[model samples]
Target: MQPNQFNVDAANKLKIVSLVSVGKHPQSGRMRRADQDSRAVELGLKLTGDNHSGESLVVLHAGDPGEPNLRSYAGMGLKSVRVLQLDPAADAILPLGQHLQQCGADIVLTGVRAESGESSGMVPYQLAEKLGWPIVPRVADIVSVKGGVAEVLQALPRGQRRSVMVKLPFIASVDSAAPEARQSAFGPASRALMDIEVVSASVDDVRQAWEEAAARKRPKRLKVVKAKTAAERFKAATAKSQGDGGKVMKNESAAEQAQAIFDLLKEEGVLR
Candidate 1:
């Protein structure tokens, strides 16, 4: 099949890649739910194909071969899919980039954060840096693709949205606002097999030393805002609030009560 013919539902198509990690279950130490891994497979499907008609799709699952999560990922979708095995000890970010570099995918889609591992939400940035490609983080939708540029919708805080266009070979960290991934259609997915594509990289190219990344000085840590105990939480809830005591007195006449309340809150640091 021709390269661009991928959109025609031919046997070959571009690949969406996701990194999977084995996460220990919070309750059962023996078994884990591959939620992040499965979500990755889910995002891959939405990014590469429309619900009905579109290109054939492939999910490139990157992780260690022996991780049981690999089987779960394999069951996620079907057709032209691959489970890429990396060194069991390899740090994921760099090795993932090396694998994608060899995979020749048109686009790489990953979740904003993994359920396991460091959970730093820095993998897409690190992978883009290593691969020398652009990254669009927290993307809510793939709006359109034409002429090697894909336009995307990005989710911002306070329910705001922004539009961006990135060239092919770009990385996108899918936000939860994107369309829900479909359930694995068993007939097709069960028919699929694990086609492993092994990518070996030069040892010298991988970045190590967490200290190097820490030196960059990113966002400051937000306060935890958590109560240490249930009693503490109850005490905090019952404690007298900012207006000197339980009740916030309106300094103005009765006609202006609502406005006065708002103004009092503004003065007391309760409202922005």
Candidate 2:
């Protein structure tokens, strides 16, 4: 089914909370806005506007409110954002859970992963476990929300998509396939306000000592598939390697070129 084909209840108003985070610049190693988290905020705005159900949108953050990164989201039309102030050394899970509970939001949206330190890409699942709510990852778009359930379009590998239905009070991690975020407006950003909530939290005790090192690229490994039959084994052993080392047809007649093109397409399985 298409992404837009879904039934929605216009009367069921929803409260959606989007979590935003600061990302790091790949080349300059500087702090910058996170595209994934920003996209989630953009999707939240699209869902809450009059075109949809007119749900209320709430922006949340768990970091230094004074950070310049937070203001970037404000420029995207968020009038205010709730900031949960916690000890920098503490794990953000506990404090974030407390604030989300206080807000009484029906749906929580976040990026697939954070861009900063220890980017484990586990926040959404961890938060779901803490709140006892179902978590949907890689959501491309929210199809509809009605009858205490939400239907969403999930992104998959190979340019494919799947539809999902989850009950209310669920957490969703937006994928990059979702709509691109709008540019942050300077006027709204300058006028935006931060609502700070100080929460007491302690760092989790680590059983093992941790170490840090410079990141490096790892060599790509060839996939090894098991073959049970002799024919399958032979086919696997002779599988074509991925590279451009084929013949090139230069200086040929139109009919010959057309025949060669047809042969190449058939070889590639692009034509019968």
Whose lDDT is greatest here? 2
Which residue runs of candidate 1 sit more than 4 Å off their true CA positions? Answer: 1-15, 23-40, 50-55, 185-191, 197-272
User: What global local distance difference test value does model 1 have?
Assistant: 0.61
Instruction: Kindly list the per-residue Cα lDDT of model 1 for residues 1-272, writing each as its tens digit.
Output: 22223342321245556655555564554444345445555655555654432234555556555554445445555554565666544555666666678768777777787655566788789888998999998877666566777777788998788989888878888776765645545555455566776765443233344334322433332223479999988877666444334354557678678777788678767799
Listed per model in order, the count of residue pairs whose N, CA or C atoms clash below 3 Å is 0, 0
Q: Please give the lDDT score at residue 207 for candidate 1.
A: 36
* Tens digit per residue, CA lDDT, model 2, 1-272: 45445443441377789998888877777887788999998888777763422236788888777888888888888778788886656688988887788888888999998888667888889999999999999999998777888888899998898999999899999999998988888888887888898877887566125667778764333448799999998887778656544566778889998998788778767788
Evaluate candidate 1 by giving its C-alpha RMSD to the native, one decimal. Answer: 14.4
Off by over 4 Å in 2: 1-12, 50-55, 207-209, 218-272
Per-model TM-score, in order, reads: 0.59, 0.74
Look at candidate 2 and give me any clashing residue pairs. none
Query: What is the Å distance of residue 8 in model 1 from its true position?
Result: 7.9
